[model samples]
Target: MASFKTVMKSGHPPTLFAAFLYFDFCFAIWVLNGAMGPFITETYKLTPAQTGFMISLPILAGAIMRFPLGILAQYIGRKNAAITEMSVIILAMIYGFFFVSSYNDVLAMGVLLGIAGASFGVALSLGSGWFPPEHKGLAMGIAGAGNSGTVLAVLFAPPLAQAYGWQAVYGFAGAVMVIPLIVMIILAKEPPDSEHQSFKEHISCLFTKDGWAFSLIYVITFGGFIGLSNFLPTFFYEQFAVTKVEAGRLTMLAAFMGSGIRIVGGYFADRIGGIAVLSVVLLAAIGSFLALTSTPSLAVTTILFMLCFAALGAGNGALFQLVPLRYPTNTAVSGSMIGEIGALGGAILPNVMGFSKQYTGAFATGFVVYAVFAAVVLGCLFLWQKKWVGAWVGPRGKVIDPTPAQLQAAGRLEPIAA
Candidate 1:
C-alpha cells in the first residue's frame, strides 16, 4: 500500500492518457460492426444468425481471452500487455482492409480483431491496480469511458465507408491507430504487485457469489452500454426510417453522453459514494429502458435514448467504483473476472437483439428484453444491499457505511461474495 501510494502520488497522468487511448482503440474496434454491420449484412447476403455471429465474434474472443490476458498482464506487466494487444489490433485491422472481401473473410478478420478488443480486460486490471481505493473510481472512470470509441466508430466509419468504401475505412483506422499505439507503448507503465496466486485459486473465484454479483452488475452497465452502442444505429435506421446519416448522428450523440458521463460517475463515487450513485443511475436506466417504445413522437424517443445512455454510462463508472471498494487487494483478479463476464454479456446481448429483430421484426422487443434484464439486476442490487454491504470492508480496511440494501443483494460484495 505504501509503495502504491508513493508512485501514484507522483502522478500517473501520462499512463492514464495511454490507458484512455488503449480503451478508445479497443472499443472503437469492438463495435466496428455496429456502424458497418448493416452494410455488411447486405453485402454478404447474411442471415440474421450469420450477421450476429460475425458482429459479435470479437466480443466472444475478447471474453475468452480475458483471463489469459490477465495472467499475461501479471507476467509481462500491464504496459507490455497493452502494447502487444494494440500492435496485434493494428496488424489485424490492416489485414481486414486488404484481404477481407467475403463474409467468411470478414468473420476471420473479426476473430483477429478480437485481439484488439481484448485490450479492455488488460486495461481494466491495469488501471485499477495502479490507483488507491480513494482514487479508483475517477481513475477507472476516465480510462473506461474511452469506450466512447464507439462514437468514434460511428462518427468516422460511416462517412469514410460511404465515401472511400468500407475496406478503405479499415486502412484509414489501421493507420491512425499506429501513432497512438506507439505513443502508448512508450508512455504507459504498470504499477507493481508482489503477491502471486495459483491458477486454480484464480479460476475458483469466478464461480463464487461475489464474482457473480460483479458480473451481473457489470452486465447491466457494460453489457447494456456495449450492446446498445453496437446495435443502436441499426435500430434507428430500422425503427424511425431515418437515413444512415441521421441514425449515425443520433447514435454518436448517445455514445458521447454514455462515454462522457463515466467521468462524472467517478467523481461522485470518490465523494458522496458509489452505491448511492449506482442506485439512482440503475433505476433511471431501467425506467428509461421501459419507457422506450416505438413511439410516433420523435422528441419522446430521443429523450428516452439519451436518458437511457446517460444512466448506463454513469453506471459503468459506478460499477468500477464498487469493484475497488469491494476488492481492492485483488483488483487484477476482480477486474479481469468482471471484465470477462461483462464482455461476455456484451457479446451475447447484441446477437440476442439481432435475433429478436429477426423474429419480431422490431427493436421494441429488444428494448423490452434489455429492460427486463436491467430490472432483474436492480433486484439483485437491492438484495445484496440488504444482506451484505454492512458486513464488508473495503481494500483500505475502512468500514463503509451501510449502502443500499438493494446494492448488496445485486452482488457488489465480490472479494468473496458467491
Candidate 2:
C-alpha cells in the first residue's frame, strides 16, 4: 500500500481539495430542506406523509438532473459544470429566503435544491481523474467524503432555523456558497483524462448490464444513506419527543460516522477488494435495519442508526471503487447515470417511512421492506461478481493488468484492467 503522502503526490491535491469543498457545500445545500423538516412540519402543520413527500422531492429532482449534468460536463468540462451548478444553487437559495412562504413554495424550493444534488458525479470524477487506478478509490473516497455535508446541514441548519427562522437558513446557505465557488474558480483545473467522443459513445453505459447492476447496488448504498440522513432528525424529534435542536445533534452523531468512515472504506477496498468490502457492509446494513424495526429505546435506536450509517457509508466507497474499473473512459457519464437511478431509491425511502407511519402507526414496516430489498441486491452482487471477476476486473474486483491475448484482441490495452 502506498503512504498517504505518496497518494497525495500521485494526484493534483489542490483540485482534489477544491472538489471536496465544492461537493461538501453542495451536499449541505441539497439536504437543507430535510434538515429543517421539523420546523417546516410545524410551520405548515404537516402530516407525516406530507413531511416525507416534502423531503423526497429534492432527491427525486436531483436524480432526474444528474445524468443531464454529467452529459453537460462531458461537453463543457466537469469544473465548468460545477461552477454553473453552484451559481444556480445560489440563486435558488436566494429564492428560498425571500419567496418560500407557503407549503407549495417550500416544495418548489425543494426542486431548486436538486441543483446542489447534481454535484455528486462530477465531483467524484473530477477529483479522481488525476489519480492512477490504484489510488482512485482513495481519491474518490476523500472527495465523496464530502457527503459529510449532511453533518453541516443537520448540525447547523436546525440551530440557525431556531434562531432566525427556517427561511433565514436559506440566506445563510446562499452566502456560504460563495466560499466554495471562489475556491473552485481559483484552485480547480480540468483533468486531462477525458476523450472527445460522440454523444452515443459517452452514454453507452446506459445500455449495459453492468451499468444497471451498479445502479441497483447504489440504490441500497447511497439511497439509504441520503434517505435516512434526511429523515433521522424528524424521526428522533417525533419518535423520542426530543427538542428539534437535540434531534439534530443526535442525528449528527450517526451522520458524522458515515461521512468519516467513507475514506476508510475506500482505502481498505484498495487493499482488500471492493466486492469483499461491499459484501460485509451490506450484511451490516441488513442486520442493523432488522434491529431497528423493533423500535428500541432512544439511546439504542441512536446506536443502531450509527451502525447502519457506517455500513451505508462504507458501501458507498466500496462500490465506487469498482465503477472506474468497469467504465474507465467515461466515468463521469456512467457515474451520473448510476447516481441518477440510485437516488430514486432515496426518494422512495422517506415516502415509504412516512406512509408506513401514517397507515400502520409505526415505521417498522419501512425498515423491513428496505432490509429485504438489500438482501436481494446482495444476492445479485454475488452472482454478478462471477462474470465481472475476469471479464473486466480481477479476483474480488481488484485492479489487474490485461492479459496479452486481451490486449491483442482489442488492438490496445484497455484501461478497465490496470
Candidate 3:
C-alpha cells in the first residue's frame, strides 16, 4: 500500500492533526443546540415554531457565514482561519452557559455558533488541500464524518443536559473543545499554494454555470441531510408523539448510520465515479422520500432512515468526489465554494420543513418537494451527459480535458487524463 506521506506531501502528520481538531470543535458547535433543544423549549415555554428556530438557527448562521469564511480562508491561511473558528466556537459555547438567560439567549448562541458551522469551509479547503486528489475522497470523508459531532452531541449532550443541567452542558463543551483547539494550532500548517484572491475573483467563480449546477445538486443532497439532521427529532415528535428523549434517540441512530456510511461512499466515489454513485443515491433518496411521506410505524421509520436512506448518506460522500476533480488547480476555491453551496442547502431545507409543518401540519409536502428536486437532478444528469460526462473514468484521477469551447467556459487549464 502507498504510505500517507507518499500520496500527499501536505498530509504531513501535523496538518492532518489540525484538520481533525478543527472539525471536532466545529461539529460540536453545530449540533450543541440540538442536544439541548428539548430542555430549552421546556424551560422557555417556546412553541413548536420557536423550538424549530432554536434548533435550526445555527445552520442558518453557518450557511450565511460560509461564503465569507471561504473568502476569509483565502486571505488567512486555511489553518489559521480553521483554527480561529474553533476558538470562536469555544467562546460561543461558554457564552451560552454563562450568559443565555431566556429564549433570546439561545437565539444569540445559535447565531454565534455560526462560526462553528462555517468550519465546513475551512475543512473542505484545508483537509482536501493536505492530500493528493487521489486520496481526497476517503481522507476528506473521514474528516467530513466528523459530522458525527452531531451524533456525538445528540448522543451525549441530551443525556448530559438531563443530568448536569443545560448550563453544565455548555461548560463541558467549552472545556472539551479546548484540547482539540490547542492541538490544531500546534499541528496544522499552511497550504504551500495559499494564494489570496480579490473579492471580485471569488465572486467571479460563483457566477459560472458550473458553479450554479454544483449549488443546485448540493442543495438537495446536503440540504436534505442537514434538514433531516435538525428536524428528525421534531418529525418523530409530531408523527408518533414520542417523548423528546425517545425522539433524540431515534435521531441519534440515523445520524450514526449516516455519518458512518460516508467513508464507504467516499471509497466508492474513488472507485466507480462520483456521478455514478450520486446518481444511484439520488434515485434512492426519491424512494426514501416517498416512504417518509406515508408515515410508517416506528420500526419502519427507523428502517427507512437508517437502511433505505443510506443512499442519501452515501450521496453526501459522493458529491465531494466531484469537488477536487472540478478544479484541480484551484481546489481550495472550488472546495470552499462547494461547501458554502452545500451548507446553503442545510440552512434552507430545515426552515422550509419548519414552515411546512407549521402551516400544513405534516412533512408530506416537503417530501414531494424533495422528490421533485431529485427527479430534476436525475433528468439533468441524463440531458447533460454529453457535456457533464462523456468519458468513463474513476475518481481521483482521469481529469476531464475540455474541448476548445469548454476551455473558454471553465477558465482553467488541466491536462486530459483519458
Q: Write the per-residue lDDT of candidate 1 for residues 1-418, one digit (tens) a residue.
A: 2343453564577787788888897788767877787677777787766776777787777777777777777666788888887777778788888898888888777777677667765676666566656677778888888888999998988888778877787788788888668877787777654246566544555655766787888888887888777777777776677877677778898888899999888767666667677788889987887787555466678778778888988888877777756554456666777888888887887788779778877556767787788888888877776544555533222326545663333323234533
For residues 1-418, write the lDDT of model 2, one tens digit per residue.
7999999999999999999999999999999988999999999999999999999999999999999999999999999999999999999999999999999999999999998998899999999999988999999999999999999999999999999999999999999999999999999999998888788778878878788889999999999999998998999998999999999999899999899989988998888989999999999999999999988999999999999999999999998888887777788999899999989999999999999999999999999999999999999999999988887778887888766665332212223422
TM-score of each: 0.88, 0.97, 0.88
Candidate 2: list runs displaced more than 4 Å: 403-418
Q: How does candidate 3 score on lDDT? A: 0.71
Best by lDDT: 2
| Best candidate (score: TM-score) | 2
Cα lDDT of model 3 by residue, 1-418, tens digit = 4454564554664675567567756776687786677678779887667777778888888878877777777877788787677777777777888898878878888898777877775775676676766667766776677677777777777778878887678888888888877877777777664545466655555655555666677777766777677777767766788777787888889888877877678777766777777778888888988888888899898888885446767877777766665554455566667666777777666666767787888778877887888889877765544455643223322335446564333424332334
Clashes of 3: 0
C-alpha root-mean-square deviation, each candidate: 4.8, 3.1, 4.2
- Show model 3 residue runs off by greater than 4 Å: 1-10, 196-199, 390-418
Compute the lDDT of residue 208 as modeled in candidate 2.
80
Predicted structure 3, TM vs. truth: 0.88
Better of 1 and 3 by lDDT: 1
